[model samples]
Target: MTHNPCLSDMSKRVHRFPLFSITALLHINSTSALMLGRGLTQVTHIKLLLFFQTRHTG
Candidate 1:
């Protein structure tokens, strides 16, 4: 199967600039983060969700 370059690029970008990803997550509201997380990889989605949850609870 052909890999999607856009997804690959995004994965790379996420890895390369993790702080930026965190910052973006912080700026976005929970609903928007949930929607955005749906498109991420399973592990990444979970990680972001946990991070978002912790930010709110802690």
Candidate 2:
């Protein structure tokens, strides 16, 4: 996956920087993070739904 500038910089500074800076960086890149989070949530929900449906029907 490709990262935006804020994410790249956050990765570089993650260990060196304080929590405040990290939070600020996260906010700067919140759009990407939010999208990724929603995508993951949807995938997980779909997988669980499929698993349950198969187990119940089969």
Candidate 3:
């Protein structure tokens, strides 16, 4: 299979600015969660926590 340089480069950028990416993702999820309902909001929070932990460890 041919390698995709563009995808690799994008991944590198994400790893470099994990915080900025996480904040943007959280903002998007928060708005959607508000429209979805309380249950989704809770799920979003848990996902956010897990994301944060993984970012730190991995």
Q: Count the backbone clashes (under 3 Å) in each candidate.
A: 0, 0, 0
For model 3, what is the error of residue 14's alpha carbon versus the real structure, in angstroms, after optimal superposition?
A: 57
The reply for model 1, stretches above 4 Å from the true place, is 20-58
TM-score of each: 0.32, 0.52, 0.37
lDDT of 2 by residue, 1-58 (tens): 7759988788887767789987888787997889999999999999999999999999
Error of 2 at 13 (Å): 16
Give a tens-digit lDDT track for model 3, residues 1-58. Answer: 9999999999998789869779999999998877789778889999999999999999
Question: Model-by-model lDDT, in order?
Answer: 0.85, 0.89, 0.91
Instruction: Give per-residue CA lDDT, model 1, range 1-58, as digits (tens).
Output: 9989999999998788879778777878776878767766787978999999999999
Order by lDDT, highest first: 3, 2, 1
**Leading candidate by lDDT:** 3
